[model samples]
Target: MPLSLYLLAVAVFAMGTSEFMLAGLLPAIAPDLDVTVGAAGTLTSAFAIGLVVGAPLTAVLARALPGRWSLLGSLLLFTAAHAAGAVAPDLPVLLATRVVAALAYAGFLAVALTTAAALVPADRKGRALAVLLSGTTAATVAGVPAGAALGSALGWRAVFWAVAALCLPAALGILTGVPARRTPQDAAERPAVRAEFAQLRNPRLMAVMLLAALVNAATFAGFTYLAPVVTGTAGLEESWVPVVLVLFGAGSFTGVTAAGRLSDRHPGPVLATGGALLLLGWPALALLAHRPAALLALVFVQGALSFAVGSTLVTRVLYEAAAAPTLAGACATAALNLGAATGPLAAATTLDTPAGDLGPFWLSTLLALSALLLAAPLHPALRGTGRTDAPG
Candidate 1:
């Protein structure tokens, strides 16, 4: 991969850390801001709302700019938002900063995906996306835990400061490394607004986007509440939660890497198998929550399956929407964020019921099964040519 792609990864790692580290910091934040844990949890939804609203808007606004400039501008805004968050004195201010940061996060990711695809040959787009997305996995593994520890030691505000500091190097890397011009072919191939809108009318592309949303919803529904589940239901100490998270992140990194290689030639099978694993994994997790050994093993497996499906789903959308790859990339970001926002809100509702913490697992299982059924018609064996948009 190119240095520019790796720089993109650096930027993504900063954003991903901001996105997920809030889960671990919510405990610290709630008390400081005089709010309930449930109220603090809404911060995650706020971030996702920014992503849903910002992706398409940024895609349109940045259409004329080179990828490098667009990415750099987004990072600058992201860093500024995090700086504001670090100093935020109240819940409302902090929540507002999160929305600002996430808007930049969404724009950066959409442009990065488009830029990654532009850098590689058509056949290698899946792998290129995998490389870019690996940064998120890396954040889950390293950044989240580190931020959690820092928050515990100093304060949650310190974590935001740390994220802000990291973005400086990432912005500098992009400025120095990425080219200012799109490749001539990519520039010429850029779609007009009409063509971009036309791609959304394709049923296959829409199905892929829906699948993307379902996959993210299933994963985040359970994942957003994992700390509570680990401490209360899984019978683990609070300290051990971070260790389990590291294992889950490791599995996600491995799964996405493997999926990237397979998705180029066998996206259908990869999606089908990943959905199946998730369907089985969630129920098993719910049933075995009391057994620490089983819970640990299942956490890793669930993370792997969820991310494998996610990577493959993005590849499928890009393929099906080849006429407007950049817009498709932005839509993919929006769809996944919509799921991210919805999943936690649904899980929050479940927590209000008698079912309690276990409710999220069941919710995840149902969503995973839905994704599997939707994927049924996408069998690789039935695909006559390798094209994603072919009629079933």
Candidate 2:
């Protein structure tokens, strides 16, 4: 992997930290901002919605600009948004800042994906993408908890300020580390904007995007509601939440690492086996949520299966849309974020029902099956390296 890829991952780590840490900080933010916890929860939605809208829009807009420049600009925007958010005096202001920060996050990730894929040989695309996505796994492992702890210690605003402070070095590192010069991937440089849009018309690519989205929805639904299952269902102390989450994160890291090595050679088998295991995991989670030992073990196993499948799909999306390299990254980000936003929102509907915490598990099962069903026809498409020169 290139140093630039690691630098991009660092930036991604910063963004990913801000992305979901708000889930833990909501309790602190609600009273300070004078909103109900339910209303304060909209901040997470704002970020998710921003990501869905911003990724493709920003990538399309930045098509003519250098990738490094785009990365720097997004980081600056992200940092500024966080700084403003840290001082926001009202809920609406904080929500707006979240949206703006998410837009920046989407933009940075959109560019980062394509840039990372472009950094290596066609055969190594999956591994390259994994290197980039490892940042998110790392965020789940370390950054999210650290942000939550900081918020608990100082206040929610402290977490915002800390994220802002963290972005500065990442932005600087990216600006200096990412080279401006082009490579083989840039040879077809400057595909017309309309031509890029046309790539979206490809059925296989679009199908892959949808499959990726649905798979993400399943895992995130489970992830979003995990604390409840760990506490209310399994009867664990609230303090154990972070420990369990770390296990999930560690599992995710392992999943992505394994996928990096296997994805290029075995995309079909990886997706099929991972998806099946995840399909089986949700119901088992529902059954075992009461068994602390079983629940902990299941969380780790499910986490591994979830990302092993999710990362491979993301890698597939990038290659399948190689004809529109810039837009591919954005679409991948948009699709994946769309699921991130949707899963939690969907799972939330199941919460107040008799099913309670286990509702997300059932919902995840359905989502996982839907993703598998969608991928059923795309096996031929997923088999190749997806060279840019191939048919669009």
Candidate 3:
């Protein structure tokens, strides 16, 4: 892989940090902006709305500029949006900033996917995408926690300022390291815009995306409300929540990087085994969640399976939709955002039930099982790791 691919990871690290760290800062933001914590939570919704609304549009509009230039422009917009957010006078202004930043984030990620994959050889495409996504997993392990610490020490606004400042270097890296000329994926290699959208009608790609979304939904279902699970169900101290998160993050990072190396060589088994373990592991989690040790172990295991399998499914989507390079990235982005949004919403329904805190595990298990069943029939298509797209 090229040094420029790692530069893309740097940009992804900044954006991923901004995307998730806001959760930790919400309480401070709510009080500071004179809104309830629940009201401030709408900022996340605003971010989701931007991703859902902007993803396809970004894919459509990205062809207007060369790949590196598109990345540079989006990073600049993201930086500017966060800087505005840091000084917002009210929640509405902050909310608007979140939407704009998320839109830019979507654009950056869509371009990064194709750009990263294009920089590498056909055989290394899956790993290239994985390298870019490592920035997000790294954010899970370190960046968000650091942002939370920054929020605690300097205030939440300072966290935003820090994120904006970080993006400047990433943007500079893009400007300096990434190529201005378009790659095969973006320039001469692309199909017509109408042809790109036409891939949506392909059932193989659709099914793969469905599986990807379910896997992500299962991940979030178990993950989003984990503080409660760790403290409430596992009976661990609140202080242990961060430690559990680190375990999960470490496991996920290991899983994804491993997936990068293995996915192109063994896509089918990678997806199937991960999905099956998720199906089994979630039940074990629900049953033994009362045991602190069992809960901690399962948290790491589940996180590993979720990301390793989920990453494979994402690569499969690109393979199935290989003919539509631009739309492939956009579709992967949409599927992930869909799962992330729905997972917590689905698990939220079970919080007051007899399952209580353990419901997320049960729900995640079902979602994972559903995803695997969907993938079972599609295995043959996914198994083809080599390039399947025709010449330009």
The most accurate candidate by TM-score is 1
Global lDDT scores for all candidate models: 0.83, 0.84, 0.80
The runs of at least 3 residues in candidate 1 whose Cα sits more than 4 Å from the true structure, single-residue gaps closed, are: 183-186, 378-392
Please provide, for model 3 over 145-180, each residue's C-alpha lDDT reduced to its tens digit, 9 standing for 90 to 100. 677667767888999999999998898899889877
Per-model TM-score on C-alpha atoms: 0.95, 0.92, 0.89
Q: In what order do the candidates fall by lDDT, top score first?
A: 2, 1, 3
Tell me which residue pairs clash in candidate 2: none
Expressed as tens digits, the lDDT of each residue in 85-138 for candidate 1 is 999989899989999998998888888888888788878888998999899989
Which pairs in model 1 have colliding backbones?
none
- Tens digits of per-residue lDDT, candidate 2, 69-126, equal 8899999999999999999999999989999999999989998999898889877888
TM-score of 2: 0.92
Off by over 4 Å in 2: 30-40, 181-188, 385-392
Better of 1 and 3 by lDDT: 1
